[model samples]
Target: MAPKDVMTNCHAKSILNAMNALRKSSTLCDVTLRVEQKDFAAHRIVLAACSDYFCAMFTSELSEKDKPYVDIQGLTASTMEILLDFVYTETVHVTVENVQELLPAACLLQLKGVKQACCEFLESQLDPSNCLGIRDFAETHNCVDLMQAAEVFSQKHFPEVVQHEEFILLNREEVEKLIKCDEIQVDSEEPVFEAVINWVKHSKKEREDSLPELLQYVRMPLLTPRYITDVIDTE
Candidate 1:
């Protein structure tokens, strides 16, 4: 008889589900990941399959490769659990309360998908009051798209944004960066000037010296003659 070839229908989820069950039972687990005083048992192969971090750690001659237990720093135990769930199920849970912490942890694990999802969630939550804070957060985390989106939103809502505490807390360079942008949406130069003054006076002793520098960016030519003589002169 001629050689016969056969194929069987199978789904990938079955394998993951089986692995998840084994993980829960602590069966065939090769390592225990310790985080924040909690120990999580898992299979190195499964972790290697999901995270570049684990893959490199297990494959390289690093001290952790042959260790029976490894300590995971810079992450809370809950975050570690969430990441493990994602590795085993290809799913994750994100919420407003957790995203700020989760995104950094995901980045450390080199889980780009999780980091992107967290960034999108933050972007969706942006508003006039919070856009500045979000932009700063995105910048600190190197989430380029989120930072750009937040910047555009901040400009679109500049009038309302200056009223928030986040704007007042911005350092000199950050304030200069915002006011110097020609794209800042303001009906007149009045608001821009007011924003600069407010930011400077928030810590007058420390920031007062920068007032003249920031004022230079506010276009005086755009102000009306009456207001300039009245409001502008009084300042």
Candidate 2:
């Protein structure tokens, strides 16, 4: 070897350990976070280093910079605890029970890593029964990769997905969007036609206006002549 090289501080574990100890002991903590009736002591430097929201609050000439105790609105105490733990530990347990709530809280705090973890967790949990809901949730939260993944999975499993109770819960526009997808798989057009009819019948007052538009998505030529005649008579 041209020179002897040495590696130190594997994974920065020592630094993280010290920071975690500070977090636990509340030593040198300069700020108090009040979230949904609970308080958490935290260091400004650590929070600023981890979150843009906290960074702006601490670094700016804003009134919050001088405040010893700040109230964080719209997040529950438990969610705040998890957020603080991630800030100190650089890790979090994203579960089905928590991802839905955690994603929004992470987004509010501008914690990109936790938000991304929630999105990844949601992506891994997609299934025929939940893909649509997950897709909607991802879209609502502006998670592009998770939204696309859920949308594609839902489209590919549209036949099976539509049979789920969640399908009937989809509003008129959502139903239209799914029906218009060319990638939706079905052995025959009958299922698609029957799904549309069932959706319309489920809430005629709300869905009747879209019946004519919904019917256009069905492949009439592929349906049996008898069924086609029966549809025409009903129309």
Residue 68 of model 1, lDDT score: 98
For model 2, residues 104-205, the per-residue Cα lDDT tens digits are: 999999999999999999888988889988988898889999999998898788788888878999898888989888888788887888788778777777
Model 1 earns a TM-score of 0.88
lDDT of 1 by residue, 1-235 (tens): 9998886555688899999999999999999999998999999999888889999999999999999999999999999999899989888888998998899999899887788889999999999889998988889889999999999999989989999999998999999999899888999888998888777767778886787678788986755545533543344
For candidate 2, give the lDDT of residue 173. 85
lDDT of 2 at 2: 85
* lDDT (0 to 1) per candidate: 0.88, 0.87
TM-score of 2: 0.90
Candidate 2: regions farther than 4 A off: 1-6, 9-11, 222-235
